[model samples]
Target: MSSQPETYEFQAESRQLLNLVVHSIYSNKDIFLRELISNASDALDKLRLESLLDSALDADTSDLHIALETDSEQRTLTVRDNGIGMSRDEVVQLIGTIAKSGTAEFARKLKEAREAQDAAASAELIGNFGVGFYSSFMVADKVSLVTRRAGEAEGTRWESSGEGTYTLAAVADAPQGTEVTLHLKPEDTEDHLYDYTAEHKLRAVVRQHSDFIPWPVRMETEKPKEGGEGGEGDEAGGTERVVETINSMKALWSRSADEITEDEYKEFYKHVSHDWTDPLETIHTRAEGTFEYQALLFIPSRAPLDLFQQGARRGVNLYVKRVFIMDDCESLLPDYLRFVKGVVDAQDLSLNVSRETLQQDRQIQLMHRRLVKKVLSSVKSMRTKDADKYRTFWGEFGRAVKEGLLSDYENREAILEVSSFPSTHDAEEQTGLRDYVSRMKEGQDAIYYLTGESRTRLENSPHMEAFREKGLEVLLLTDPVDEVWVEQVREFDGKPLQSIAKGQVDLDGEKDDEDDSAKDAKNAERAQREKDFGPLLGWLGTALAEDVKEVRLSSRLTTSPACIVGDADDVTPTLEKMYRAMGQELPRIKRILEINPDHPLVTALRASYEKDSGDAALTETAELLHGMALLAEGGELKDPARFTRVLAGRLAAGL
Candidate 1:
C-alpha cells in the first residue's frame, strides 16, 4: 500500500506498443472513441458478472453505466464508467505492464488465425489483444486514468504521455469507478478530430459502432430550455444540461428474425463491414441446443479488395452473454468463407475467456462447423431461388468457394453443387456440373472441361477442336483456381471430370448410321495417313526430344498443326505455369506433342520426310511446330530469339 507517487518505465513490449498506438496502430483516429467506450463497457460487464458471484461487491454501487463528456475549450474527452476498477498495484500491472504470457499468447493466436484465414477466430481475439486501452494514444497527446476498486479504501491515478514512462499514485476518498481523460493532440484537433468532441458526432459514432452495447452509454448535452425559461431566479435564458442515453443497448442478434427488418440488418452490416452496398445474403440463426448461440451472418454483394490477400482481416464481431468480447474473431467461420460478415453472441461461453483459451474451445469449434454449414446452405438457396443473383455472387466469390473443395473435404459436395463455369455451348452463359451432366450426349460417360487463361481463349483452343466437332459440350474453366479444385473433384455425379487439354480426349459414343463401306473407307484413309507420317513422327520425336515426351499423329486435333497434352498422371501446363508463378518448383514434365494428321502443314511435312528422312529442313519444321503449340497453350519458349530467327528463315525459304 504505497501511497507515495511512483514513476516506472513501461515494459519493453509495452513501450513498443505505446509507440505504435500513438503513430500507426489504427488507420482511423475516430476509432479511439470506440475503443475507449468498448473498454468502459467491458469494465461494467466485469463488475456485473462479479456481483452475481459475490454479493458483497455490489454493496457500494448497484448502478452500472458509462458516461462520455467532452470539453471543447480544454480539448479533452473523458469517458467515465461505474464498474469494477483497479487499485495501485492493479493499475501498474494492467496499465503499465501488459502480461508477457497474455500478450504473447494473444499475438500467437492472432497470427495463427490470420495465417489460417480463420476470420471468426481473428474477430473474437481483437479486444482480447490487451491493446484497446493503448488505442487512446492514437489521438491523444497525454492520457490520465483514475480508478478505485470496489470496496477498496483508495484509488489510483495513472498519467502518461505514452512515451516510455508513466506515473502512479494513490488517492483518498475516490469514487468506486474509473474515469479516463484524453488530452487531444494539437494536430488531432487541427485535423478536425475535434469533431468527436461535438455531441452530434459522439452520438453518431456510438450508434454506429456500439448500438448493441448492453449497458446504457449516457452522454451529457445542452438543450434549449422548455418555454424559453432557465429557472425562477436565473439571470438569463440558457441551455440546460441533460443526460441522454446514446446507445441502443439492445443486442440486435438476440432479437427474433420476425422482429428485425431488412433495413435494420443492412444498417448493422454497414456498421460491421464498413461497406456501403447491400449484402447479397443474410442468414440469422438462434441455436438452442447444448451449446446455445445467436448468429447473424451476411454475404457482401462485392468482393473486398483484400479478399485474396493472405491473412487479411475478415472476422465477425463476437460477444458472450451480450457482453462485447472481441471483433474479427476468425475461428467462428472457416477460412474459405472469410467474406461473410456479421456477429455471433454465445450464451454458453465465459465472458472472461482469453483468446488463447478460445483457440481450443470445443464450443467455438462446434459453432464454426455450424456456421459454415449455414453459410453454404444460404449460398445454395441463392443459386436455386435467385440464379441471377447467385451468378453475381459467383462472379465475386466463386474462386473462394471452389477453394473449399480443396481445403474443406467434408463440404466439397455442397460447394460443387453451387459452382458454375463457362461452357463451349454458350460463350456468355455459365453452367453447373449437374446441368452439364443432364445435357450429356448419348453414351457419353465423362464430363469434359478445358482450363486456360480466359473463356475466349479456351473456347478457341486447339485441344478442344475434336470435342467441338463431335458436338460434345466442354466446360471452359478460366479461373486460376479451376485447375486446383478440378484435381480434388475428380468426378461429379459419378462421371469423371475429364480435362480436354490433359491426357487423351476420348468422347466414345454410339456410332453414326454410316454404311459399312463408308466406315471402312474412313478407316483405310486414317491407316494410310498414319503409315505415311510414321517416319515424320519418328524424326520429329528425335528432333524435339528435349522439349516433348513423345510425338504422335493426332486423334483429337482437327484444325491446328500441333497441340500439347500433359501425361494422364502429370500436372497440366496451365497448372505448371500457375505453380511457377507462385515461386514453386516441381520437376518439369515434358508434354506429349500431337500433330494433326489432316492439317496441311503435317501433310506436307510427311511428304518431305518421305523423300529424305535426314533432311535438316524437316528438323527445323519440327521445332517450329512445337513452338507454335507452346505459344497456343499460353506458354513461353526457352529460345524466343532462336524461334524468331528460324521462323524468319522458314518464311524467307517459302518466298
Candidate 2:
C-alpha cells in the first residue's frame, strides 16, 4: 500500500516565480518541452557519472535513455528518463524550494525581458536562473514526478498544482528513473493552442531542442502497415505500436568544423543560447596537447538583458569525454568574457569532477589560458575580416570586453586593438584606438579622452573646449567600466591615454612661426598676468580652499570661464560615482580649479578681486565660479542650495 501523502507549502518566492513563469515568460511555450528534456538529460548524465564511481549504482545502466509517452484522451504528456532520481530529501530541497542564490536578480531580469518582449533573453534566462523545472508550470496545471534513486529501495512521488503547495508520498513500485507527467490545462486543448499530447509535436520539439543530447530519446508511436501483412503476432490489417529513437544523440562539439554546416551551427547555437537571433561569430577549436579538449564558442548578436547583474552565472557547458558535467563551468573563462556561450569538452577532466576540483586543476587552468587566447584571436579576426559585423559585436558587448582590459593584464593589448569607441571627431561611427592614433595631430603626444555618462554631455563638456579648438580628437568614453579600464590601460600603442579633464595639456608643440622674440613676448605677457593676479588668485583659493586642491591660472581652457581638473593620481568624477554606487568609501580627493585667463567672466572677477581683496563680492564670485566649474565638469556641488542662494542674491542685486 502507498503511504499517505504529506502536504507542504511552497516557499513564498517559489509561488511568485511559478506565477511569473506561467504568465509573464510567454514568448515561446514550446520551451517547456526543451527544459524538461534538458533536465532529464542532466539526470542521466549525473547517473552515468555516479555509476562509474560506484559499481552498485550500475545495476540497470545498460540501456540509459529517455522515453516519452502521450495520452490524448487522458490529456497528459509524460517524459521519463532512466537516470539519477532524487531521494525524498533531495526532492524536498531541489523541487520544493528555490534554493539558488540571486533569486531576486533572476526575478528582476525575467520581468525586464517579459516587459521588453525579448523572447531570446527570456528563454535563455530560464536555464541560467535554475528555474527550468518551474517552467513546466507554464503549460501544465498539474505536474507529477515519481522516481527512486539508483541505490534506494523506496521511491518518492511528488505532485504539485503550482498553487502554493505540493504533496509527497512513498511508492513501492515506482521506476528507478524519474517520470514527469503533466496534466495539460484546458486552453492547451483549444484550437490553435499547442497540444502537448500529440506525438508529432513531441517528436518535433525533441528533435529541435534535444537532437544533440548524448542519450537516445525514444517515443512510442503507432504506424500502419504499408502491405496487408502481419509480423509475428501483429494483426494483418492493424497498426503496430513501435518505439522509435528521435534524437541524433551526437555531440556537436565532438565533430570537426569541416563536417558541420552553417545551418547546423546556427541550430546548435539556438539550442545552447536559447536565442532566436543568429550568432555574430562562431569559433570551433580542437586542441590536442598535454590536455586535449574541443571548444565551440559563439558571440551573440545582442547582449543578454541580465549580462551585468551582480554575480551572474557565466562560462560554457562543461563536458568530459562527451559526458555533460555542468551547465556553467566558471573556470573555463574569465568573468569579462562571461557573455560568450558554447560548450567545452575535455577528455582530461574526471567525470566526477566538482566545481571546487575544477578550480584547482592545473590542466583546467592551462586549458583556460589557451581558450582565452583562442577567443581573443577569433575576435581579432572578426575585427579584421568584417568591420560591420565587428561593429555590431562592439555595440552589444564592448563594455564587457572592456573589462578584460582591467582584469586580464596579459591580453590587454589585443583587447585594445579590437576595441572601438565614439570620438569627438565622428559621432556617427565608433573609432578604434589605432585609427585615433593614426589621425592624431603631427606633434600630439597623448591619446586624449573624456569619460562621462552620456555622449551628448561629454561633447558639450568644458573640459573638451581646448582639445576641440586644437583639432585634436578625444575618445568619448560613456560606459561606467571605461573609467576603471582607462586607469589600468594608462597608455595604448606607446601613446599615453590622457583625460582632457585631468592634468596639464600642451598642444602648442614647437610652433614653427614662434621665434625667440615671439616666445619671449608670450612668456613676458604670461609673467605679467601672473604677477598682476597673484593676490587675487591667493584670495580666491582661500575662499574655495576646502573644495579645491589649488586654484590656478589656466592654459588648457580657451573659452570656458572655469573648469575642474583632477590631479595626476586622482579619480575621475565618473569613477567616484561608480565607487559610491558600489557602496565603497574612498578618501576624498580635491580637484584643481583652472580659470581661463582670457575669458570675460574671469577678467571681471580679477578686476573686482584687485579692487577689494577682502570684498564679500569677490568671495561670492569665487564660490560661484567654483560651483559653475563643478557643474560643468559633471561633478555634483557639495552645497547646491547655498550656491543657488548666492546666485539668486547676485541676480537680485543686479535687477
Q: Looking at model 1, how many pairs of residues clash?
A: 19
Off by over 4 Å in 1: 1-64, 70-210, 220-248, 350-361, 508-528
* Segments of candidate 2 deviating more than 4 angstroms: 6-30, 52-60, 71-75, 89-142, 160-166, 183-201, 221-242, 274-278, 289-291, 385-388, 510-521, 580-584
User: How well does each candidate superpose onto the true structure, as a TM-score?
Assistant: 0.71, 0.86
Give candidate 2's whole-model lDDT. 0.83
On lDDT, the candidate that comes out on top is 2
* Candidate no. 1 TM-score: 0.71
* C-alpha positional error of residue 131 in candidate 2 after TM-score superposition, expressed in Å: 4.8
Q: List the residue pairs that clash in candidate 2.
A: none
Scored by lDDT, model 1 comes in at 0.80
Tens digit per residue, CA lDDT, model 1, 342-379 = 99999989876666887799999889888988888888
Model 2: per-residue lDDT, tens digit, 143-242?
9999888888889999999888999999998878899999987664332348888788888888777788888999998787555355565566677778
